[model samples]
Target: MTNDPAIAFRVTALEDNQPNGREPILGGILRKKAVWVDESLCIGCTYCSCVATNTFTMEPDNGRARAFRQDGDSTEVIQEAIDTCPVNCIDWVKFEDLDDLRSQLNAKTIRPLGLPPLR
Candidate 1:
């Protein structure tokens, strides 16, 4: 392994090109589970961003990662990102529950990097 620090996750063989992160989203077009990143749990490691280049992106202000486009990348690529996450912040959620989850997240406190905490 090279010490380049650039590579996020390695796909050794062609067989490794499967979405082994979670069970296949079988069913019709309306799949219930979709990928999401919990900003509160994110460590801003950038591993997800590097792995899923088109799917995940880092918020400049907080340095935390978020899923910009749900279908930006392939399932295998996104799975790799989710798996490579050291904090396991990335996850799947129901489409109908996204609003509630967002509301809950909004109620939580977020302390971004390079900032002082309030007293």
Candidate 2:
């Protein structure tokens, strides 16, 4: 949560490409954006946690990765974690939409180990 504002801004630099027009608020935006891991799509690889220790943690029960702390690490580190996801489950998302994503996650069934259904 104590990440540098510049680094945070660098993370939001992609905000320009997004549809939302939310203006930068310096410190206000430190947690404005976040990385999301779809547990249903998660493969329990733990690469995200390994890359962004502060931001991600592995779930004990399901053995899936979760975004436990928003803005817990530098944006670069979190992005690295996203890139390491072999299943392409991790993604960048708007802060406000998190609740809905969580709701969906809550309703979803985690994909079993070994193989996932074709998209």
Candidate 3:
């Protein structure tokens, strides 16, 4: 693995191996982070794609939004997409905290579609 001394991170290019598209996140010696998209809850609204195109894309088979890579865009931009998801299906997590976050996602808590806005 090649190291970028400036960033102090080991570079592993996913673009060459992954056929689906650009990888969103990159792991390195410094930072450990990840972005997770709940496909079952995704509405395919394209909002996330618009806000953080580099980080997310629609799955070819299901059309739900998916995060192919975590480092394609800035965390702030990706967070905006997560916050704006009408269904609240997107999230960011520490690389080690992914499983814990998954357990907290309960379908019963998901907001129903086309419901009247809160007063």
Candidate 4:
């Protein structure tokens, strides 16, 4: 809670001093790997969406990519999307901390697009 509306995610932890919004290249539980897109730097490249169609989709308004469903594709495929992002705006985050990150981001809550057969 600061008054700044741009900050979306927040976490209050006493013992573990881990940075609240640090984005890891490959971290988090395998079953709960979470993905997020940084709208500021995202060039609206379709690389991620094309690589992981099920996991990512382009926002109609800005054409920026967002993760509609973290589990839409396998972690391996999602990684491909992240790697393919030329601007490197996509991030892999721990699922348990996802809510904290989302809450602090300026973006709205994203609903999972649903689990489909992995592409």
Candidate 5:
């Protein structure tokens, strides 16, 4: 394994609409902490992927959850993944500091499809 801390993978949130018809809201971040995937805790449900497919994936070998990309160092993507975790296995540190993360996740500068840009 790489001894370099920067070489390690990181997960972040990317806020999106809830599938259950809930109000569209920006999710929070998991802070500098990594989302620990507990094999025993996970039921193999792809709820995480459903929210942030870019950051999460099902490990084919173990049929468990794993990080899909390590490029998610931003708070926006990290929080979205954590919010979507069905089992609540994902947790956050510096939860009080998430205002910045929330702003980044919910920033209206760049509008997604079907949404209008914020003036």
Candidate 6:
């Protein structure tokens, strides 16, 4: 992790979901957004599971992380999984809205680290 305060703040905010914080989108006519995990980058750490156990799971075979839609789960749970990702491999795709909240959250973390903002 970097010593940048902005990066630190983003990490904390993502973990806590600050007030006026971004909300995860749920099922609607538009498909609910999801966080895609990168199997290659994942170290098999279950950090995401700590935040949203229902949304994320570790595959015993590859030690890669997986995300799925759980019954009665809200969008926030998904966001929590994305936020907790240590390697930052998760990518969010919008099913309906042009602007996906999951992508935006990822952007915030990258931008402060001087990382190219995701499109």
| lDDT tens digits by residue: candidate 2, 56-118 | 899877788999877577676778889899999999999888899999988976655665665
lDDT score for residue 7 of model 2: 81
Query: Which is better, 1 or 2, measured by lDDT?
Result: 1
Q: Scored by Cα lDDT, where does model 6 land?
A: 0.57
Q: Which of the two, 2 or 6, has more lDDT?
A: 2
lDDT of each: 0.79, 0.77, 0.72, 0.72, 0.53, 0.57
Q: Candidate 6's error at 80, in angstroms? A: 2.0
Q: Compared to the true structure, candidate 6 yields what TM-score? A: 0.48
In model 5, state the lDDT of residue 21. 18
Model 5 global lDDT (CA atoms, 0 to 1)? 0.53
lDDT of 3 by residue, 10-115 (tens): 6665766632223454553334568988876887788998888898888765577878766777667888888889999887668787766667654335444444
Report the Cα lDDT for residue 63, model 6: 65
* lDDT of model 1 at position 16: 58
**Greater-TM-score candidate between 3 and 6:** 3
TM-scores for all predictions? 0.69, 0.67, 0.56, 0.59, 0.43, 0.48
CA lDDT for candidate 1: 0.79
Per-residue lDDT, model 6, residue 55, is 61
* Cα lDDT over the full model 3: 0.72
What's the true lDDT of residue 100 in model 2?
Answer: 98
Question: lDDT per residue, candidate 6, 1-119, as tens digits?
Answer: 65676665556435564323123334444435545665556766788766666666776655667665432235566676677778887667554532354455346432222235568
Candidate order by TM-score, highest to lowest?
A: 1, 2, 4, 3, 6, 5
lDDT of 3 at 20: 28
Off by over 4 Å in 1: 1-31
- Per-residue lDDT tens digits for candidate 4, residues 35-107, read 9887656778789989888878888765678788765776777888899999999998787877776666667
Q: Pick the candidate with the highest TM-score.
A: 1
